[model samples]
Target: MTKAELVFIPFPGIGHLVSTVDVAKLLVDRDERLSITFLIMKAGVDSKVDRFIDSVSAACKCIRFIDLPKDEHDPNQPILLSFIESQKPHVKEEVSKLVSHSELSHDSPRLAGIVVDMFCTSMIDVAKEFGVPSYLFFTSGAAFLGLEFYIQALHDEQKVDPTEFKDSDAELVMPWLTNPLPAKLLPSFLLHKEWMPVFLGQTRRFRETKGIIVNTFEELESHAVSSFFKGNTPPVYPVGPILNLNRDGDHNPRSDRSNKYKDIIQWLDDQPQSSVVYLCFGSAGSFDMDQVKEIACALEQSGHRFLWSLRQPPPRDKMEPPTDYVNFQEVLPEGFLDRTIEIGKVIGWAPQVDVLAHPSVGGFVSHCGWNSILESIWFGVPVAAWPLHGDEQFNAFQIIIELELGVEIKMDYRKELFF
Candidate 1:
């Protein structure tokens, strides 16, 4: 009997790509008769993503990576939506070729289905053409999915303008939500004209898919999971808490890269158990000069052992390539480095999972990216939620207010009153 083969198409961002990769790993591990083909859409910047994918492929025999053809799109548009729209022709052509080739080979694993990232809802057309089921991989928790569905439903059934969320100060009352959600905690997209149409457009396409596999466990979000089953919505799977494998494997390439930062590990080793706080925002999270200075002052005042993964802002020209280095002296407080040299160590990029997994690390200051949130929870590290964009405000609410697992620092950088 032939084993089942599933194709996974994930949005190009690291967070989405990592969650989809873990889902692929989980699917294969749970069912011995399954194989996964991970179709990685190349990002505008590809080096780090390429390295990460290559490392995972080297370790897993059941998973394979296929690079989809890339196209140029408007930089101002939402990156996820732009990528999905631009890749339509390329994705269709590639999926057709993959399906055809598999049918021709008697020894090949049977094509079971296509699993697409939530952003790539339009890919369901390709699945329809091939007569295969398409499932959406919702990288966030089930609650976000429920909210998106409710918003989309409201727009279709009641002619409610999702854009009204922008100017309205009223509490968002949805049937699925147990309590009214304040306007401030809504996703940034819903509150901005530039992003609202694109977000709502994607949400509308979601109902057309055959099923959705969310990255959250049933027990953790039972209410949210149950809410997704209203009327004609597809089957929902709460198959998560799925995380990256432990980084301690000697043969692991991610850890091999960590060897370059032996000093950082040594610093963690010197601290008392669970004594250090790890501060890292996601790829897009970075502070201005004023914010950086304030953080430096706070770190110095606290006198806690710290590891901060700091990132400089993106280039002003979207088309311009990013620089490899940033001058820490220019952005940080005056004499900040010298003063906190004994207490805090700041670096550009960090192996976050490894840092959080460390015995000496106790808490995380995060941008509330869903992947980072899950990683923090997996390591049993408490969070100081500092959400930057998208659904981060909603996630901060989930963590700090609803769940009582973390604390919230205000999202406004100008109001940087909290340490």
Candidate 2:
């Protein structure tokens, strides 16, 4: 049988890489003749992403992994785009080697396509170099993807900048959504002109792809998924709820108290059913002291059984994962831990899927991350979205304001941290 090969260029972040790996797994599993090679790129000191290399490589024999050569990132350029562009040459070289000299290659190469991450559209040129099609892998839900299509068309094709109207209290009645989306709830990238160019450039390239593979399903987002059929957008495949249910293969961000995985589970086992509120923002989700104090105060006063996964913010401008707090006293409000000690548990680096799957977890207070939202839905836990950045605010709107699957603590709260 002839072999069909696919090259995956996922954003180096752990969250993006996880979903990208899931897609690779699905493709290879569904086809006997297909094989995928993940061209892993280096990020600034993430041991978790390294674990993905180890875990994913071991779990699936059909899938292959290749580490792209490291290069100096341009400091002036934007972080995500900058790192992706710098690896263009490495990607090109690796693809050349794969097509020409790999053991899997036959007399006639059947190179299929390149699958680039949502943020790594800069790799399209590399895909075009090989005369192969390029597909985009979107990690978010279908509703947010539709929003991007509308906003991009509004700005580029229609010649109206959406950022200019962000200050106003306007609601947009979009076809995909039943309710109006507050202009304030639009993505932070849309609200800021400086950030507009990067996202706009990406959405512009969305038109360039052979197709888009978004992580969602029709039953959950029928309106949003159906709208794509009527638009001038790329073919969108809503293959989602792509979760790593296997605990042995699950990828976690932090390494500290690795023992806490079992400990937390045991603790939850003792709690009353559906009584605990699980507050785990995305891996990079964290806050400053003032915001931490406010969260502590709320949790303390509410007196509900809670599990908060708190990580210290990465140092300013650094691209590393958030570290475990050395001292909870300095960070938490005075007497906050003691007062809430009986009702709650504070730990570092949660095994999100496992925690969400626990019966004790009643509701999730999340960063409104697409993956986390899917997990919440899968486990039948309602979300209380408190988005930090990226497409989260828009995702917050979809779940709370649009579908009403959950409530919102705040929609417009953008994180103050630069990283």
Candidate 3:
């Protein structure tokens, strides 16, 4: 049989890359005829991503990783968007080389398609040049993708900007959702006029792809997934809960940060089953000192067995890897840690999935990132959501208000999402 191949261009983030690789693993495992090549974009500031690539390479012979040369970033456009756009030429170059190689090798697979991450829609041009079908891999749930489509159509139908109502307290009756979603609750990108066009533009390009493969299933988002089937849109494939479950093999290998959270896990081993409340925001999720103090106070007052994954706020002026607070005492209320020492343990950047999966973990007070939400559901740990940013607010809305699966700490991302 002739070989078949698919090229993957995941967004420049570890989570997106991991999920994309997971999809590739599923594909190759199901059909031995197929092999996938990942055109890895240089994104992260550290070696964490590189280490993941190395580990995955060792584990999967069917997958290939080609790191593209670092392109000069465009300062005028949005950072992530600009970075992705700059890689177009590099991606095209790599794909061309692949075509050349395949042409020379009798056994090499014929290029079947290209899979572009949702944010990397710009790379569709490369697929068009190669005469290959381009499928969009959406890392978030179908509900959020539906919201993007809804917002785009909503703006197009009225020929009005949704940001016009940014100041008012208004709700939108969206087709994908069972109830009206508050305008205030839409992702912050849609609320601001500056970012509105950028995100809406990306959403518009989604329709241009051959199909969209969402990291979700119909059962998880029946309404939203159904909406995709209603329109004359591209085919939708809900092949998800696509996650990297091999925590033991994760490149971190529990080498760098494992020591940090081992004590917390040991403490959890002593706790009763379903007795500890686990509070952790996603990797990018963090709070200001005021929010931290309020959380400590609440945990102190409740006297519940808790394991809090406390983190420090990011640099005010720049985006970088997560910065867990230097000292919990500096951020927490004075003496709060000592008083609650018996009942709780606050650790920096807890192994979130591990913590959530623990039998002792009864509940998750989460930032409601789509991934965090999925992990919580997967573990059968209930969630009290406080959406931090981006599509998180929308995710929180979907689970809490639409699906009735979770409760809300607050609907406002601007305010404290504390207990």
Candidate 4:
């Protein structure tokens, strides 16, 4: 019997790629006969993804990394889409070329299939074209997937305008979901009538896939997962807490940078179990000086020990933070760091998953990225959800309020402030 060659197509983002890569690693680890290849987008290749790929490849002999060219006609270039039409043909061509040129023998091993993220459903067509089975990897919870699918139905029934539903106060109560979700708790792409075509196309692509793999375990979302798969024909696999699969050892790629923030772990180590809070807003989320100051004040006022990642705000030529506030650390309530030094550990970036998994991490203040939510839940850490933009608000709602796993911080959503 020959081994199987599996290729994974990850969505072009940190959260999606990270989750998919973990799944690929798990599959390779379980089956020695499996060879895995991660196909990343050209523009999507960055320091973080490259570092992770290097680590995985170095750790596993059968895993490989490949980059696909920038699609000439990417429909989702400026805006995220329900389906990525333009990238399909280019992806298909690249996959075919890679398989054909590889030296693996048919007698020794054979092309197995492609595993694709839910958002990149366009890859389904490519897999079909290549005559390889493809599985849909939903990089979100079953509840959100069900909500998105139901919204598509509502769009078809003309019960509501997709654009109007975004800001509307209408409560969406789906039979397949655990609770009623607010209209605002949906993906922003659903608000664009222009996205209707792509949305439908993407849904169709999902229905056509061989199977669906979700990044949630059955223990966490039994009802939602059961409801979702009961209505669909494809096999649904709930193989998760996948983020916890990797052990904290010397294998960590970021160990060198880990020392730069040893004070963080030391502080957490000092705290009582489930007493301290871990704060991280993820790589893409940002705050202006005023917002940063407010958050700093809040944390200081709460007198909670926190570890915050403060990055240089978007460049002046690009999106300026605030006119009154020139520096990020400047806006912190005066002597903020000194006052909280006993309790707080402020660094530009910290080892996120490692921090969350620590025994002392009581709760998480997060931007509500799906991967972050899953990681928090996997480690059984509750969250204080503060969503910014994109699908973050939706993810926050699903995990915090809907799932009874965390709390949402009440704040004025539209207010913008200067330091």
Candidate 5:
């Protein structure tokens, strides 16, 4: 009997790619009879993405990575929407070509299906062309998906104008949702027409997929999940928290690149068991100079030992962090390093999973990305959610308000502090 072949196409973002990689790892581990191929966009192959691919490939023998050419327009540039629109055709073509070639090999396992990120809806047609089932992977929770679907229905009913909803002080209540959701709590991106088009377009494509996989547990969001599938017969799998499945592996990787911040691990080792806090806002979240200073002050006052990952803001011309800001600690609050020498550690970047898993680490101050939220929960660590932007607000809402897993921090004009 031939093994089943599956191709995973993840959205070109850190959180989405990470969650998708976890699912891919899980699929291959459950059954050796499955072979997996990961289709990565050319634009998504950055240093971080490459590192992740290497880590997963090392652990899973049945997994492979296939890179496609990035769109001609830079993915990091300001005109992101234009780039995605222009790149859609190429993405479809490349994926179809790969599937066709894979089918030609006599020894190849039959193509079982394609698993696509919710954002990568362009691949649905290609899956149809190849006569294979395609599944939509919503890298977020069921609540957010329910919100998007409701918004789409409202738009179709002509009850709401996407542009007017941006400023209208109306609170949207969707009784159909399993949980009580307010329009105000919907993803902030939906407020604008430009962003609405992207999401709504994706949602339109999502309805066409054969099935949907949400990265959550049935026990965690049963109400929302139940409401989501009430009428829709498509298969829904709540096969998570996926991060819990890989807790046994040793994640440390040795490299010549000495993490200029090795003191973090040493500090963590010194702390009392479950006494220290780990603070990280992910790679994309940023704060202005004033906000940075305020946060530094708050961490100093918190009186608990901490490991704070700070990144300097990008230069005016470039999207990448300024070269000089690479040494992040020097710019911190005056005497910040000297004052907290025994209790606090500052690193530009640390192996997040390893840090979170450490025996002494008890709490996380996070940007509330779904992957980070699930990881914290998987490790049984409480969180101090401080979502800065994007779907983080939604993720934080679910974890802090809905699940009662953590505390939410309010940002005041004076400083960034946790209560």
Candidate 6:
């Protein structure tokens, strides 16, 4: 009898990779007979992502990493969907080879199926080529999945242009959702003609997969999860609340880094239980100097202890990092850090999961990344939804308006207003 194995192909982004990796770990844990092969798209070199992969591979022998063939795509390209679309041929080739080897080698685990990230739906053809099943592992909630399908259906069947209502205040109706969705809450991709087709095509391809695996539980999005099977759609599995709990020892040990970690922990320890607020945007999030000053003023007025993970905005020349960057203090208000030294800790990067797990973290001021929102829910910390862009607007609506899990923070990036 051969061991069962599944191949996971996650989107290159860190957020997508992390969640799918969590799901992969859970699958291996549940069944010792199962193992996973994680195909990393050679998108680019990222230090944090590489460190995470190294740690996970060290911890779990059952998980393996394979680097896909690299291409010369422009790192500064504004449209990511085009890049993902171009990689289909390479992905299909790699997946075919792996599937063939699994079948041929007696010692290798038998190929069970190929699990693909929602962004990489093009791999469905690869699965069919090898006569293996394909599954979509959505990193976000089922509600978002439901919305994607609804958007695609409208585009195909009704010939509705979502971008037409980009500036409109009209409400849109959907069968799965009880409340009317505001036009502004739609994902940003719908507003752009170029990206719309890529997204819609991916959603339409969802019907071709064996099933969809979502990173949420039944209690969280019962309506959305239930709506998937209203017709002949594939089975939907909500097997998550998947978190990276054991990430403490993943980093290289350092006394200086250890001291900073201890200092932050000690600060939290001193605060009253459930009294402090933690504010962290995702890795890609940042603010201009004007916005930073306003936030500083708000924090001062609130008189609350906060741990803010701050990063400077991407360079104006292009939405990419410079070879060398200036200190965070250069972008903050003059003497701002000095005044807030006692009440706040403005760090460059933080161990987000660990920080959220802290007992003193009462509130989370988030950019409303799906992963961050789920982490807040898992830790029982309340969220102050401050969505930046992309799918965050709809996610904020889901949490603040639909489920009543969090409160929405009015975001007007250009206006300099204190909270």
Candidate with better lDDT, 4 vs 6:
6
Better of 4 and 6 by TM-score: 6
lDDT of 1 by residue, 1-419 (tens): 67789988898777678778888887889888899987777657746677778778888999999888778776776655676778878878777777788789877777789998987887888888888898999998887887887777777789887777654566776655566777667776765667777778888778778788989987777777777666568888888987775542321324766565677777888889998999988755777678888988899999998899887766544532223246888888889889888888888767777788889999899888888888888889999988877778777777776677898787422111100
For residue 273, give model 5's deviation from the true position in Å. Answer: 2.6
Writing each residue's lDDT as its tens digit, candidate 5 over 1-419 gives 67688888886665677778878777888888898888776543346666667767776779888776665665453344444455567656766665677679767677788898886777777678778899999888777777777778778776676657543456566533434443454565666655677777778787888888989887878777777667553667787786634422222422333344355566777899998888888766566777778888988888888887777655444323222255555677778888988788777655677788889999999888777887898788899888765667667767876788999784111111110
Pairs that clash in candidate 2: none
lDDT on C-alpha atoms for all candidate structures: 0.77, 0.84, 0.81, 0.69, 0.70, 0.77
Q: When superposed on Cα atoms, how far off is each prediction in RMSD?
A: 3.6, 2.3, 2.9, 4.5, 4.4, 3.8
lDDT per residue for candidate 3 within 1-419, as digits (tens), equals 88999999987566677778889999999989999999988754645567678778988999999988877667777777778888899999989988999999989898999999988888888999999999999999988888898889888877868787676788888777889888888877887766789888888889989999998988889888998788867899999888677752332325563465667778999999999999987666788778788888999999899999887765653435466677888888889888988889988766777788789999889888777778888889988988877788888888888777888898666532211
Tens digit of lDDT per residue, candidate 4, span 1-419? 47778878887666577778778778878888888877776443346556666666777778788776664443434334412455666677767776775545455456789888887886787888888898999887776667666766776666666678757888788865667777765665666566555665576677788888888887877887788656754677888866734633322424673465566666677888887788777756667768888888888989876777676554433212212223545757788878898878776655787788789888898878777888887789998888765567777777766678988884114222111
Better by lDDT, candidate 2 or 1: 2
> TM-score of the candidate numbered 2?
0.95
> Judged by TM-score relative to the true structure, which candidate is superior, 3 or 4?
3
TM-score of 3: 0.93
Sliding window of 10 residues with minimal summed lDDT for model 4: 410-419
What TM-score against the true fold does each predicted structure earn?
0.91, 0.95, 0.93, 0.85, 0.86, 0.90
Q: Pick the candidate with the highest lDDT.
A: 2
Clashing pairs in 5: none
- Per-residue CA lDDT of candidate 2, range 32-99, in tens? 78888899888777877777678778879878888888777788977766778889888988998887
* Clash counts for the predictions, in order: 0, 0, 0, 0, 0, 0
Q: Provide the global lDDT of candidate 2 against the true structure.
A: 0.84
Error of 5 at 204 (Å): 1.6
Error of 6 at 302 (Å): 2.7
Between 5 and 6, whose TM-score is larger? 6
Which ten-residue region of model 2 has the weakest summed lDDT? 248-257
Q: List the residue pairs that clash in candidate 1.
A: none
